[model samples]
Target: MPLTGYTIPRSPTGRSSLVPYPPWHYVGDFLVVEYWADPDKAVTVLPNGLDPHPDAGRCALVFADWQSCSDAGGELLDPSRSQYKECFVVVNALLDGEEVTTCPFIWVDRDFALTRGWLQGFPKKLGSIWVTRTFGLDSPADPGVRAGARFGATCAAYERRVAEATVTLERISETGPTHNDPPIVNVRHFARLEAGRHDEPAVHELARSRSRDRIVSPVWEGVATLSLYGAEHEEHDLLAPVRVGKGFRFTFGYTVDDQEIVKDIRS
Candidate 1:
């Protein structure tokens, strides 16, 4: 068989011709809150070849309002073109004796974001995400500079609710790191068919750099309350928060540039 040479447009006209590119840029406000869970429960959800760090009972919940674009300049032209929201849950774990984080569940509101995330190996599902901020009014004598923020997210699969949570914060202050945690690691799973003959599923353990190509303009910490709901999907039970930890909010932007795949999971 002979092949024809043709130019593939950067912005393909059809869905079937879409190509995934790197340096994906996103500008967003996010809330990152950690919670304490049963240590035994945390270990159970991890995929094969990953283990929870001994004494690793921490779960982090993130709510993000994203204005994402394929390139840096596209964001300023029309920020609303690819605006979306996402919420995800990750737990501290160990991979090959190194501390890492594992995301067992996540939800996003946009289809393009969902598809892009899946290509990156995130366990992302479609759902609704809402975040709100309220400022407190101060009297003339006293200058009040505090505000409250609320985050809510719900995920459904096959017409059933899989997981949902509400997090509220009354006060936030710009502060330093309250705790030192390891970089995030994800179980990336995708399938590839080569030459329409060879089919194989890839499951890799990927780690993201903690400080590269990421901008945290201002990081704020606050006290928060978390309320988790029951789930129709049993896998989500691993995320049920038993105790609350520190709450944080930040304005962040990042370019997806450096990621190391530690190992591949074959089983």
Candidate 2:
């Protein structure tokens, strides 16, 4: 029989054991906090050949509840494979004279999400994420979408709390959130497995996410607070916010099938 597979642990079936082939569709509700971090510290996390945004060192900490499905849409029926949560930090930077955003750190709760993120150049790891959920009940226990409503979220890994954020909805935004509006840039890096080829990576390049059918819901912006805690193995604290800005809550959807390689380091 001819071998067939798109990813690891291949079987006679071409389907990947982890995640199916794209175009993967996603719908997510997010709580985002925008802030400025130490410019010097922020620059340290950017991949080589990129520079910090000339205006300021801006970063957005995002907590998301996501539902994803492949083109076949079978995963939607199998909820286990389609639902997950994530937390990530995106920093604004300059790539080849153009403004771009890069994800320096990210954590997801599902193995499939983690593997999928790796393929897209996001360095995703396992973490527990919790976000305040809203309900439709007309009672105090259920928070409604309106002024004075507060939302909170937290992310932790290896039993260590990494970050926390709180946002109090003050008003609806007409222009939407600005923190993550730029094109996303990421570095795809995979080291060679052979001991002798340790210095050379199998893949090392700058990539931009190419997502279609993007949609954004009405955004809610308000006062916000964020705190970052340093863990023994995590360096995210280095990007701790120097000045916290507006907080936003929004829902968005998009489809991803491919990426654009901006530069190949090894070429």
Candidate 3:
């Protein structure tokens, strides 16, 4: 018997697998808040190869509602596999004199999204994420994208609230956040299960995002507030904000075709 080309739970139709092979297409609406944290605490969370950024401790908490589909486009018809909510922590870091972003923590509402993230070196966990939805209708709750409009988002894991953010739209921004333009770097690490290989990982490397066909909407900037909660088994407090910066809301789309390895240290 033969199996599928990629992913597990292979079958004749490959329907049992969680994620399919790229190119994966995603479009998402996002609410992001920028902040600065304690540089000392940040150093402990970043990976070894990454150095602290010059303007150290700069970070962003992003809340997104997304719809994704593969090249086949079959998943688009199945909402269960195509739609998800996500929240993540992005930290600025430097790798060989080049500025890049790294995600130290992330949470999603679906399993497929988690697996897809792991493949790209994102440490994604299961959590409940919610982002305020806006509409074009003329109603009190359905606020339009304009000055004075407010947006709220929250993330919770293990039945504990992890973080929350509120952004009040002040004006339309001509340019989006520049800090996020840097290529995202991630540590792709997979531990081995063999008895003798317990001390080593089967795959350990640094990879950069290779997404293409990017499209972004007009960004909205505003005043914002953020709060991070500490929990028994979680370290969300490590990146607590020292100074909260501006907030932004936008929509963007990109395609995940592949990844480029920047470092390989498999042993």
Candidate 4:
């Protein structure tokens, strides 16, 4: 009930920064899902933040674990930490068909917001990622069922909410986009749910910090299966991925994704 009425705010490059559900797929007998990932290989501008990933040498998914499920605490604290909303639910989704099999949820956000990450102890730039997000769910350690579900899942739902299409960057070519490196995926990448677990209830967890986080509430709280509540421009600094291409405006590579409706940022 509460999840249905929520609306994504509106404003453009207006950066507030940061922000899944799926079909009958299930995880440990409960949940719903969705996520993003790289669609192609990046030759890699630098290797410090792009060291040899565990999924190296093969086509695998990449995941960004921003916070641990156990550490999520309290209602998420807003910019001022005054207002608060308890967590809603932990979700999972299935991977939509892609040019590649890479899953972005293992280590990334549904919005593709770049956060702190490392290869060794070194930092990483956001440009090095090479995957697109997909959504689905199933029992622990089991690949989620593509269609209907029976039982034994950690959490499951009846519907998978993927966008009209999966977004990808394309080179200016008559055929398609190309990259220098091969795509990789996260073999250990599994859909994790951090949600309310109830139809009309809300919950929040303590989000972990690097060094004794002084936050009164969770920064991210936990993982979620997100859908486009709709685009908004909260802070002017936040920019959409769309830009000019030749004479046509380009954002996502495919027509389906490009037409999903986004808040065009203006200067």
Writing each residue's lDDT as its tens digit, candidate 2 over 55-132 gives 557999999999999888999998999999999999999998888899999999999999889889999999999998
lDDT of 1 by residue, 59-162 (tens): 87777888876654554576455688887778887778877777778888877677767656678888777664323455444323244444454555555665
Q: What is the C-alpha lDDT of each candidate?
A: 0.64, 0.90, 0.89, 0.20
What does candidate 3 score on TM? Answer: 0.96
Task: Write the residue-wise lDDT of candidate 3 on 163-224 in tens digits.
Answer: 99999999998776765568899888888899987879988888998989999889999999
Better of 1 and 4 by lDDT: 1
TM-score of each: 0.75, 0.96, 0.96, 0.18
Residue 53 Cα positional deviation in candidate 1, in Å, after optimal superposition: 1.1
| Candidate 4 per-residue C-alpha lDDT over 1-267 given as tens digits, one digit per residue, 9 for 90 to 100 | 122311123235423322111111111111212222221221121121123333222221112212221112221233221111111111111122122222222112222122211111111222211212223544454333232211111111123221111222222224221110123221211123546633321221111112222222111111222222112311101111122111100112100000111111111
Better of 2 and 4 by TM-score: 2
Model 1 weakest 10-residue run by lDDT: 2-11
State the local distance difference test value for candidate 4.
0.20
Ranking according to lDDT, highest score first: 2, 3, 1, 4
Model 2: lDDT equals 0.90
Cα-based lDDT at residue 111, candidate 4: 28
